[model samples]
Target: MQQCSYCVNFTPAFQIIAMTKPATLKEIARRLNVSVSTVSRALHDHPSIGLRTRTQVHQLAQELNYEPNKTAIFFKQGKTFTIGVILPNLSEEFFSMAITGIEQTALKHSYNVLMGQSHDLPELEKRITATMKDHRVDGLIISLAKDSKDFEHFNQLDKYNIPVVFFDRIPPQKTAHYVSCNLRPGISQAVQFLIKKGHKRIALINGPSSLLATKERMEGYTAALHAKKIKIDMGLVVSTDLSTGGTEDAMKQLLALKNPPTAIITFNDYVALDAIRYARRHNKKINQDLSFVSCANLPITHYLDTPPLASVEQFPREQGEKAMEIMLQLLTRGEELKQKGQFFQTELESRLELIEP
Candidate 1:
């Protein structure tokens, strides 16, 4: 029984791979005749690990092509060094910009991002969150699903000792950590700008009542109108699901009023585009028969021939970076910071950006 040349050559190579398939910490420990923890400490050059032991471990590690498993290394420290990010829709320019900021900031701290898009569905948002929880992500950053109101999924993270930071679409209840844009200032500014332009009948096409942003828009509208001695008109206000059809319906509602508004303030540029298109479809002259102002200041709006007269710059990317920074602080500054009741919230003021349109 003579063995084939191929079999003889493959046997040793296959055995070598079998021995180091994973090249785990336990394997290294067994080889060095040391405890797993001891080998881990020596690899990290901890002071408790003697210099000779550390040196030998390093030399052996280099010779054996032993790469430290980051998962094991982080597990001992009770961290995954990975954060989860959930967004309403990754296709939106605003959220895409936010992702860029979050990823860049996470990279600076040697962390990885696990991203999920909820597509504005509440159930999808909950599922994504649960999946991330199953993965044991150290922290989570979310721009909530537009339709989500229960918030129980967000609340459950607290029970599991996971820190979550919200940005853009913050919950009305301020119990958890968040970074958000205060839409009042910018909305008021937009209202005043419209008033200055001699548009007395201003309409508000806001989002669903579940959102803090919708409430802020209503507040700013009334506040600005009050400041200018104009009576607030409930008939001029309408709510939208923020879909193209929903925005169109809101525009129709406002336009149907006997005292139709000469100007409209929409939730965001996306909504404004839809509203403007709806008006155009009805033969209304944009910025003339129906002037428009919106929020989000999305970059895609710049390419539109008739963008909003002005938009509120929410600084999505800055908000994202700030949110990530907060998550890092909560994670790195001990568990007490991310405990049951303590919270860190930062709100940036939205600025009304005047556009050529």
Candidate 2:
């Protein structure tokens, strides 16, 4: 009546015990009184395998704790069933949520994800891409670094017959398919909210000048200002790299101006949070002394001591899913997959309330 150490929940000693070899498919097939091919087809969920027989084979394998050798499967199929994911940084909650969506979709399709971070450096980004290529990944998903102005790093993927897809912070040249929020309507909505509050002088804290999102958002800000018959005040807008230090510098510059803006729009919620912190240093109450709005409306922004006057919530999860769907099709199909490559866009603008007054 002796039970195995694992079954008895014993803290077994590694030196005293021998490691048990994993059960193989052949052993399970023998136990089930079935051919090896039949067991494999059943394990793979082959449509040809009868449901009743498949259930019996699966139950037998479970009893044996059978595990298929993935290496053998990969060798036979000539596919690693792995995808590489490159992001500027994973600390940001926005990228984390987007990654969650990508992981979910990749798992459902029985593919593995290889992750890499660029840390917003161009040379590092190139190195990561090269490493992923060396791994012979089946596909790649990327959100380019702030300094990645050239697409040559990703060009290697094409040379290796690997598909690359972009999302959120995409490359400068849209040579491949990408999925991201349309920033125009979101920025327009945020600016209009400030105008509705009777604030004529508005300022923008944008991301790096090289980013496509920054350019698009600036355009939206300019268009909104023109529509309201307000001349674009070049001094009011401060283009800074998206960072805490950058945001603080921008806020200080605006506060120093003799004619400071009554409202400010930021590249993202994180930037707005930094602005709020800066405003507190100067004894300026947010939404009272100055109205604030930002893009990428993450939940953390809402929990701040002083939340933004409004925010724009883009569908990052959907963007991730759409990017994967396109990459999958392109890898499996050919030029026919181009239909799915069409940009998938969504928008969500916060309903501004007079939180201050």
Candidate 3:
């Protein structure tokens, strides 16, 4: 009769066990024959709590899989302990490296990071900014999209006293903290290196004319050519949306010129790759018939059989680290402690490397 009764109670017993919730602080206190306040102070490592009690509390908490209620803590501290990052393209090597730096720095400070990609679209950039604001992130780090002309979306964050730091593709704002690379020197060095390799007719496969990097890079190219007493040919400069097909189109147009360039400088590695493909199709040998150089020396370039002759390193990771550092300082030391419109630039020459042919 008892054996039959055991089977009859099995289903109900399982149901009761399934309904039991996770262990709580009160439950721990009851088990240890102590007051709830005592358990709380012990878990918090309060100075008044005895060392033995704190150790016991920590051990039991771990055993019970206890986790503090972050929502409740947010209410008490008025901070979400989270930072939001908005980038143009997550697939790009530059942004990916930058994210690693930002995440590492954030975790070291016990803060969480939330990321959003705009895919280089203006409207999506606005939506991403709005979503980050809605989540009540303590701060924001952003690299403006290729077509992000309006910055009104960021003004809402200012209304809430939230600080913002820009990195890489920064906007034209005069009152924002920024971390960037000095493009002029890097571009100049790249061009001069190509010239030294005995390539005089140099073409530039640039990105959208609106980008600040594009402007700076163009300045560098022009300056380098001027230093060498070479005439600036507008025909050699082709502006594209930086799409694969756009890059191919730019390459085709350059190669069709009456006197095509013997060397080329691209905006980034992606453009450089497209140029390589185009050159191969036209029976041109990279680093031989046509010297190549570009920015954002992505890791993949090192593994390629025919890598660029040289790549200008932008130090994306350093940019991210600096941006986070500035953000944390603003958060802890207050906005007044930082000068308005303050900007930091990572070292350019250290990042540039000449790939052996």
Candidate 4:
């Protein structure tokens, strides 16, 4: 492949010194010996501006590197042309893919995204939400922290007319707007696959009970067992705080059961990895004495020696696109949706997929 001339001749940053600030219309007008309004009109090619005036303005703007102030323009239009997005963990592959979709969607609409990570702390989430509100962002897209408890931080955004769109790990019992995965389909597939393989004692390692996602996982796991006429065993289920130690603890509790599970369904790929390590420490072979399945279908799992027999594909990138789409709708509808006391709620199906790469 031939390198572009521009790339080959690019200046080294260390050698480039004393770069000038971007020129403004006033500077261009002064240089062109014209009024600011005349320069603006000429630059915009207004019909009233003559050819000679436009030519001079364009030439001056090019020489001075003059550019319009988009912030001022958006401010005049009662918008910042920016949106806020908060996530629990950016390092997770699922969240990384979600960010990719979010950035792509935001770019299409000519909006900039301001990202924040809560690191799974409610206090940090609260501060980030406050910061977003102060930023006067057009809208917000958030996936709540695992331990997020208070809704007041989010509630205050409503006062500023900032629309909130919750994606994966959405808040429980709130209905303004959200685009999250429906876990039933994927969890059911995992559970049934285990059952078909004669693993009757299937267990689940879930997130903290405080999390709405944990409840969703629980519902899906039991519902799947119920559909197959398998007995629901609370003893087979364990909850973790989503830490490595917590995951190992959950695995220990499950292993100590009078009749330990033959297979396990984990909260996510990370949790599964921790559990697999714990199982190995206890001399349980992966996918033989004990098999596993997980959510998120993180690519890291496929790279491991013994990945899950299968994983629930949450399609986080699609979730981000859907969430951004909903945010756009909310921003467009503005007060109309609020006035009507109506909201936009949608769900993307979670599939049992993503393996054999």
Residue 356, model 3: Cα distance from true site in angstroms: 2.7
TM-score for each predicted model, relative to the true structure: 0.87, 0.81, 0.86, 0.91
Which parts of model 3 are misplaced by more than 4 Å?
1-20, 25-39, 45-65, 338-351
Please give, for residues 59-107, the per-residue lDDT of candidate 1 as tens digits. Answer: 7777677887777678878888899999999999999999999999999
Q: For model 1, what is the error of residue 345's alpha carbon versus the real structure, in angstroms, after optimal superposition?
A: 1.9
> What is the per-residue lDDT of model 4 for residues 136-208, given as tens digits with 9 covering 90 to 100?
8999999999888787888888888899999988777556588888887888889988998899999999898
Worst 10 residues of 2 by lDDT: 348-357
Clashing pairs in 1: none
Ranking by lDDT: 1, 4, 3, 2
Best by TM-score: 4
Error of 4 at 53 (Å): 1.4
TM-score of 3: 0.86
RMSD after Cα superposition, model 2: 5.3
The segments of candidate 2 whose C-alpha lies over 4 angstroms from its true place after superposition are: 1-19, 23-66, 335-357
lDDT value, residue 231 of candidate 2? 93
Q: Model 2 Cα displacement at 40 (Å)?
A: 7.2
RMSD of each: 3.9, 5.3, 4.1, 5.9
Residue 59, candidate 1: how far off, in angstroms? 3.9
Positional deviation of 148 in candidate 1, in angstroms?
Answer: 1.7
Where does candidate 2 clash, by residue pair?
none
